[model samples]
Target chain A: MHEMALMGDILDIIMKDAESKGIKQFSRIDLIVGELSNAMPDALTMAFEIYKEQNAQLFTKDASLHIQFEEAISECIFCKTVYKPDFKISICPSCHMPSGKLISGETFQVLSYEGE
Target chain B: MEVKLNTNVLTNNNVAADYNRDLFHKTKTLVINVMSSPGAGKTTLLEETIKKLSKQYRIGVIEGDLATEKDADRIRQLGAKAVQINTHGGCHLDARMVVATLPEFDFEEIDILFIENVGNLVCPSGYDLGQNHKVAVLSVPEGNDKIPKYPQMFMRTELVLLNKVDLLPYLDFDVETAKEDLKGINPESTLLPLSAKTQEGMDSWYSWIDEAYQACLKQ
Candidate 1:
C-alpha cells in the first residue's frame, strides 16, 4: 500500500508539474513486492480503479494494470546458503543458529510502466 | 496518434522516502519503526522505553493505529513528543504517513524516534518509513509458533523483542525452537527477551537503543 500510495502522490506531482497532453490510456505497472511484503495485488487494483474514477482527468483512467511480483530471498552467511523460504521461516535450512547479518530482499521495485 | 508513456507508479513515494531518510540522517537521530501483531506489547514497550531512555536521549513517537489518539495520548503523558497518524483502515504506516507527521516534533532535539506501526506483522515490513532500523515485537503470550507463522516480519527486522516472558512458566512454548527458526530466517537479527509488565531484562533493550542512537550520531 505504501508503494501504491507513493505512486499516487507521484502521479499527482507529475500531472501538476508536466501538463503535456494529460492522460489517454495506461499500460503495464510492474511491481517488485518481496515475497514477504504482504501486499495484495487485486486489492491494490480495486483501490486504483476507485481512485481513477474519481480523478480520471489527470490519469489514464482506462489503462490496464499489470503487476510483476518479486520474491524475497535471503543469504545464509554462516553456511553461505542462498534460498527462498516460505513466508514463514527466518532461519537457514542447513544451519540452525541465528545470523550476524541479514540482507533485505531488495525485491521492492517498480520495474517500469507505460501510458496508453 | 497514441502516446506511450513509461512511468513508475511508486516513483513519487520513493522520492518522498528518500527525502525523509535524508532528513533523519541530517538530524543525527535514530528512527526505529516498531511493529507487531495487535496486543503485542508495543505500547507497553514504548512506555517503558520512554521512561527509561528519555533522560539520556530525547525520544519522540509517531503512533499509527486504525483509530485512536489513545496511544499518542499515552506517549505524551510520558513527556515525549508524540504524534498520531491514524491509518483509518490501512494496515501500516508508509513513508508518506510518517512524512505527514514530521512537523509535529523537533527532530533536532530527538535522539530517537519510535514509530509504533499498526499491529500487524505482515504489511508494515514491506514498506520503508525512512527509518534507521525496523524493530519487531513478538509477545510470548501470542505463542512460540509465531516465528514460522510470520516469517517476513522477523526476517526483515533489525531486532526482535520476545515480550511477555513472564507468562512463559504457564505456557507450552519452546523458546529455543522459536529462536532457532527466527535465527534460521534472520541470523543477524538481534533477539531480546523480556516482560514489559515485569520489566525483566529490559536493560538490554535500553542498551540496544543507546547503541542505535550512537550510530545515528556518527551518521
Candidate 2:
C-alpha cells in the first residue's frame, strides 16, 4: 500500500527534524488523518510498527502512533446545509444538488512527536 | 519533549510534484496522468490516442508498471518516445519517480506527455505526478458500483474514460447510471464513453486533448 510510502515520508521528516534537535529516541508520533485523505489510519499504524522494528535504536520499545481522526464534513453551496459527507462530492439534502463543498476531512499531516 | 512539526506527511512528494509541474509549465507540455484498475485498457486507449494525435503533435509517454516495459514498448512501436519506469513492487508512481525519468525525454520536441500510471485506481489518485489533468478509466466490465465503491479515485479525477463500450451489448453496465454516480461523487467530472478496441467515440477524446493542449499553451 502507498501508506508505507506515506509513512516513510513522515519518518524522514521526523528523523531530519529530530536529529537537528538532538533527540535520539522517539516515544510517540502524533498524526492527524482525515476520512477523505485517501490514507487509512490502520495501515499507517502498521507501517509505523514496521519502521520502528527496523530502526529499533531510534524508537522506544513501546513507541506508539497517535492518530487524530477527522470526520468528513461538507456544506452545500446552494442550500447552505451542513452534513457529514459519504464521499468528497456529496449531494445536498436540502437542495438535492451535488453542490456540497467539502469543508474538512482531507487532511493527512504529522502534528507533533514526543522524544528526548 | 513534544516537538511541534505540523507538517504534511506527503510534503516531500508534494514538493517534488511542484518542481515537476514548474518544469512542465516552463516547457509548455500538457502532461496528463492516466490511471485505472489493472486491465482497464489504458494502454489501448493511449495507443489509439497517440496514433490519432501523432500527425498533429509530437507525443511522449512515461509508462509505469510493477515490472515490465511492455506498455512502453507498445508506445515506442508507434514511433513516439517512451520511457518505462518499473516500480519493482510499488503500487503507484510518485512525483520523484517521474522526475527521475525527465532526462530521458527532450521536452522541447514533446508536445504532450501521457503518464500511464501503475494500474491501480486507489493509490495513483493519491499521488500527484505534476500532470495537467488526472483521468480515470473505468471499463464496462468493472460494473456500475465502482464509482461509489472507489470514491477517492472518482472524486479526485476530472475525467472518467468509460472504456470497453463495445461489450456493452452483452453486459449489464448502464452508461446513464455511471454518469449519475460520477456526478454524485464529483459533480465537475465528465465521463466519456468510448471503445478503444473498436475506435468508437474516440474523436471526442482526441478533441478533449486538443482543447487541453490549447489551454496549456494559453497558460
Residue A64 CA displacement from its true place in model 2, Å:
1.4
Worst 10 residues of 2 chain B by lDDT: B121-130
Mind sharing the TM-score for model 2?
0.98
Estimate, for each residue in A1-116, the C-alpha lDDT of model 1 and write its tens digit.
Answer: 44466456435644543456554444435455544446556766676676667767645645655556665665666787776755434456678544323344444445444553
Which sections of candidate 2 miss by over 4 Å? none
First chain TM-score, candidate 2: 0.92
Each model's lDDT comes to 0.75, 0.93
Off by over 4 Å in 1: A1-23, A27-34, A48-63, A71-84, A87-116, B1-9
Best by DockQ: 2
What DockQ would you assign to candidate 2? 0.75
Residues B1-219 of candidate 2 have per-residue lDDT tens digits of 999999998889999999999999999999999999999999999999988899999999999999988999999999999999999999999999999999998998999999999999788888888899999999999999889988889989999999999999999999999999899889999999999999998989998999999999999
DockQ, 0 to 1 scale, candidate 1? 0.36
Find the candidate with the highest TM-score and give its number.
2
